[model samples]
Target chain A: MARLSDVIEKFIKSLLEESEGELELQRNELADYFECAPSQINYVLATRFSVSHGYYIESRRGGGGYIRIVCLDVDKNNFLHYLVSEGIGSRITEHDALHIVQRLLEQNYIAPKSAGLIKSAITDKAIGIPSTLKDTIRANILKSMITAVMAWQGK
Target chain B: MARLSDVIEKFIKSLLEESEGELELQRNELADYFECAPSQINYVLATRFSVSHGYYIESRRGGGGYIRIVCLDVDKNNFLHYLVSEGIGSRITEHDALHIVQRLLEQNYIAPKSAGLIKSAITDKAIGIPSTLKDTIRANILKSMITAVMAWQGK
Candidate 1:
């Protein structure tokens, strides 16, 4: 038999896999199932499923209350292949794009030097436009270009 | 007479300028010089010099301990160029990959239509992969493709 926590973890993961927009659960019901304290469920949620870990959670109080989770799915392999087929088409934003680069750098998927270059290119102030639209356009263009390059490599 | 707080701020900034990496200081010693409470020094550090303000500070307490500060000269422009030269490989999901695209668009480094296409391409249905690997792959491919395109553009 699995530990209550492990079982709960797997249960949540399965729910995430099946759910479309979000996943929800009740603390008391879950506790009853595991024959453990409600706090244990909270602990698992806090540590195992977090935004940094690519999961989002929400909870409610009172009757019919439940906890909800959302998983952010981003594959690490074969991304290059997809981008190449996608093609570079428009502008991209500084903030939106930097997160992607940061994550890649964090995972050691790309070189630090490369991360720096991408940051500079995407956030270059000289691009010349209304400040509001700059980041948005930069992000689009970056996507298109990256996709194009990836597609070319695929050939 | 110069305000004690002013003196401390200048001292820290000077240390940042002279030091190659991070700077360290003692809270009690600084407090003693300023003729103020230790918390005052803490206040100065929190306000005047912060990681978000391009400086990182860390401290330890209990017998002969001190604070450490690091200044990060984040040259956004140069960093992007370096990123392009390096590479991102692997599969990634649409959401994470879009971040880079968005940043590039914001900075006016890329166009708009390109971003949309990339977004559409990286979506779950488009990539056809398990949720867990989507973001990771998206990040990797996004970087790789972008670097490749940037390289071609240079040539």
Candidate 2:
């Protein structure tokens, strides 16, 4: 027999997938369905799901209160499609660009060496004077190169 | 006479300048060296140096515990180049993309008009794409424009 927490976790994930937007679940009701403590739901959420793990969770206190979870999907095909439309225009910040690169790496969308090369290329201070525009330019170049790679991968 | 606090501050700054990586120290030992209250060290760290001010401080209480401080040298230029080579291979957000442009403007690298043009081009309203590809294209275009600008600047 499967553990109650595992069952609850799967059940909640399924609900989140089925829902179009945010997923809201009542702790008590979920506990009743699983015949476990209300805190068990909390345990499953805290352990199996976290923001760092690509999940957003919110909860309210008091009667009829519920927990809301948002899933951050990083599917490779979907990411590629998304990249194609958001044409890199001119400027992008270092932090924001870094986040995108990190996300792609985490999702295995790009190889480690490729990611390192990208990081080093943009960081080469010899490219331009240190300024905000440099970050933007770096972001644009990264987006363009990555999109080209993705397009190539589709072949 | 130079105050003990002044002496300590100078000592720490010199240590930072000479040291590689983070600097570690003990509050009680430092207090004994200066012949002051342990809280005095805390006061100096809290007031003069902070992580937000480009310094990182970490400490622990109890036996044989110590404090560690790291000066963060955020190389905006290097980070930008790294983004170009690594980050642009995919999609990015308009907000993040704008941040890079803004940073470039602050650094006096790109003209303000160019930044504005790039921003308007990459926005969701501009792209009109429900998919995430908008971010990727936005990153790519930004990179190309920057590279062109850098090449021009070099000439």
Candidate 3:
């Protein structure tokens, strides 16, 4: 059987697809439906629905609280430009970088080969340095590369 | 004044260009012409004309011997495969990796953007781990990325 997290991720994706890439739901209700803890729902959202994964998430607190998820819809050229300018900060973990690459792949902004190259470049195995400075360097390099490819559209 | 090494490199490249990418000359004579030691000639050849730099050098000893330089000529599809199989070994330094990326760009096997991405990935800044294991991991990642793009020809 698939892991609970995987199942939850799929269910949320289906809902987003059906709803045209935007959806709102009650966290407690989703937890109840999945028969999992509220924390579990949070875990899925945090891991599988982050902005780096081409998703924007918003939530409110109190009795009327709801979770809003928005699949990124942007001009293809601006997508990478936005990420370079705002999304990737000075430091980023391998996980977040991979998510960005996956998002690019899914959005058809890059080919499979390009995605493979990007993944190979960003992985911890390739970026083997001191832990303290690794994330910063990774972000810098990733931004530089993305910027290099930004001019590739319509050509 | 240009550095002696740079001047020598430029001179040799011109000669190669004129000769259609192959040259034969007496090492000692060239060293004398440059007013440098035979070792300097050797240094230039070792650094600037390495196989990773898309060059091959063969030197012979004794009075009748001459140095032979051959620029790599191969089908573009076979180039990366050849490197993955025989060129990049278990370990490679940042300098060598950069050289390989440069060669690929020069040969037009990859676009400038792709080259930028590859260079960013293989740099020490990106691969910031322990000293001992850095090169090995760098080699692995470079080969993997190259292999990923090998099938991209004519597509």
lDDT of each: 0.58, 0.63, 0.79
Residues B91-119 of candidate 3 have per-residue lDDT tens digits of: 89999999999999999888887887788
Instruction: State model 3's lDDT.
Output: 0.79
lDDT of 2: 0.63
* Per-residue C-alpha lDDT of model 3 across residues A26-145, encoded as one tens digit per residue: 999989998999999999998888876778999899989999999988777777888889889888998889888888888888877778678766766555555656687668768866
Better candidate by TM-score, 2 or 3? 3
Listing every candidate in turn, what is its Cα RMSD in Å to the true structure after a full C-alpha superposition?
Answer: 15.1, 14.8, 19.4
Chain A accuracy as TM-score for every candidate: 0.47, 0.52, 0.76
Q: Write the per-residue lDDT of candidate 2 for residues A38-118, one digit (tens) a residue.
A: 898889898667764467899898987889898877667767566545634455565556556665676677655445434
Candidate 1 vs candidate 3: which has greater lDDT? Answer: 3
In the range A41-99, model 1's lDDT, one tens digit per residue, is 98888766766555788778888887888876666456544433342223445554666
Error of 2 at B2 (Å): 24
If the candidates were sorted by their DockQ against the true structure, best first, what order would they fall in? 3, 1, 2
Q: Is the docking of candidate 2 incorrect, acceptable, medium or high quality?
A: incorrect
Residue B16 of candidate 3: its Cα lDDT?
91
Q: After superposition, how far is residue B59 of candidate 3 from its true place, in Å?
A: 46
**Decoy 1 TM-score against native:** 0.33
Q: Name the candidate, 1 or 2, with the larger TM-score value.
A: 2
Can you list each candidate's DockQ?
Answer: 0.05, 0.03, 0.18
